[model samples]
Target: MARNDGYEDLGAWSEFGTVSGMVAARTTESLTEAHTGLGDRPDDLDGLPDVTVGVSAAEAIGDLAAELSPPPPKGYDNEVDADGDGTLDDATYRGRADGGVDILVDVDGDGRTDFIGADTDLDNRVDHADYDKDGDGVFEKRMFDDDGDGFLDRSVFLNPGS
Candidate 1:
């Protein structure tokens, strides 16, 4: 008799007619550990460890369900402070369902806003304090990260990319 290999079930298009992808991650811990000692071991999915310590397949099932759950709207992780003044805007917050665009705009029509868009860094909500050493329009964007953090996240360049 041949040993039963794990199975994968996939689904497309939710019942409500919305686009969705579903994947069932199944593993047999007892089977995986038992097979490792055998000379004629069946194929195993290495990406997912067969023996998840004491973690049962039931737990993995719940995790799969959570992963299959619909994704949240964009910038869901970003804590926006449109009302930096401790107030909420009457206009509906229009954050994207993807985490790409996380920008805050003045919603209350108040002239006093946090960090001018051109300022980039919200230091004092103004651009004058930034290193505009060259008096050029593209200030500080050319700065390099000597520490190599993939950004000018810290420190400033005097005349980078000039």
Candidate 2:
């Protein structure tokens, strides 16, 4: 038994001796196979085992079917892992049901600054300027020249309610 066992089974050391009747009991399979090879032992008397298999982890749990137990399902909390990085931002692991969090970060301390909503364009742009974005008073917005004519074109507006 020791020769054929692999640690993957984890039964040899768990239940070393005495039949545990576990579904993973390798000894049972071996004994069943050996019965066929008993070969000319006798045709009159009932055949019995010369040795008994050992117990298994399944038997330790008082469940002979433990050996055949399937693995538990691994699930996910989308709200917990919105970023899917397997980590949380802070020690407060409060799993929220919302997709994202809302926070305020004032980089310039102007008393009113929303990083995500700040004007990316510097053309005195508040929200929809294709040129001079970044709000630094510079025309880095690259005036939308879709036709390469160096000018702005049709505006893309947003209906907040929509």
TM-score of each: 0.18, 0.14
| Full-model lDDT for every candidate | 0.35, 0.31
Superposed on all Cα atoms, the candidates' RMSDs to the truth, in angstroms, are: 23.1, 27.0
> Candidate 1 versus the native: TM-score?
0.18
Superposed Cα deviation of residue 41, candidate 2 (Å): 99
Give the winner by lDDT. Answer: 1
In model 1, which runs have C-alpha deviations exceeding 4 angstroms? 1-48, 73-162
Each prediction's number of clashing residue pairs: 4, 11
Worst 10 residues of 1 by lDDT: 115-124
Error of 2 at 5 (Å): 99
Q: What is model 2's C-alpha RMSD?
A: 27.0
Error of 1 at 16 (Å): 68
* Candidate 1, position 56, lDDT: 51
lDDT of 2 by residue, 1-162 (tens): 344555444556655544455654776676745545657756545565443366433234423232434322223121211122565222111111232222112223333221221122222212222222233322232223244332344444223243
